[model samples]
Target: MRLKNKTLATWLTFFGGPLGLHRFYLRGFGDLMGWLLPIPTALGLYGIERVQTYGQDDLWSWLLIPMLGFAIAACALMAIIYGLMTPEKWNARFNPGADPEALPGRTNWFTVVGIAVALMVGTAVLMASLAFSFQRYFEYQIEEARKISQ
Candidate 1:
């Protein structure tokens, strides 16, 4: 069995958790979600592009927004999970035969970085969601105002 570095796993999951890069690193080709996530991501992008071109009346085209929100949430959760995992548990699960003593201690640079990245990403997603909802609400208000004026 190949020994996986806990730091690397945490970082990868932080950066590419939704894309399954961390999963691929830990589980190789057997990581089905790692390979499959791109499908919806690409489709979501396509849907977004369609919405941009065709307008919001295309409700189905807006599906990409929710898909991307889900991806962001999943990545943030994975980053937190991986960063919080103890080195001993990590070694036990991913590096069974390795000497526990050889492993790094509980806190490390990677964990710090991973946690920071997760927080940043989570905040950005939350802000973007709020902005999108506000935009939609204001647009509806404007439309109602126009209807009332006419």
Candidate 2:
């Protein structure tokens, strides 16, 4: 059995999880999700571009926004999950045949980095979403106040 590096897998998941690079690294070409995730992402980008050109009337473009968000959020969640997994469990699952004595000590810098990136990105996305909602709310309030005055 091929011994997979846990740190490497975690890093790939952090950097390219949405593209399923970590899945490929762990399970090779048999991981269909790894191979297929890019399709919707590319389609979403195309839809977004079309929407930008033609405006909100493009219903497909609006759908792509949620698709892209789900994909990105899933990746970020996976990074957190992988980073938190213990090395013993990782070895048992992914490097079963390897001698425990030969396995490298798991001072995983990749896991640390993955956790940091996931936290920062997740926080930023949450903050941005909240900011956009608040902006819209205030704009609506201002519009209501103007109509009342008129």
Q: Could you list the CA RMSD of all candidates, in the order they appear?
A: 3.6, 4.8
lDDT of 2 by residue, 1-150 (tens): 567876677667767876778889888979899998776667667766976898755555655644554566667777677677676766677777666534431536666887788878866654554564455456667878999999
Candidate 1 colliding pairs? none
List, residue by residue over 11-127, the lDDT tens digit for candidate 1: 788777768888889888787888987776677677678778988755555446656656766778777777778777777777777876445425487678778888788778757
So what's the TM-score on candidate 1?
0.75
- TM-scores, one per candidate: 0.75, 0.72
Candidate 1: C-alpha RMSD to true structure equals 3.6
Error of 1 at 5 (Å): 1.2
Name every residue pair that clashes in candidate 2. none
Model 1 Cα shift for residue 120 (angstroms):
2.3
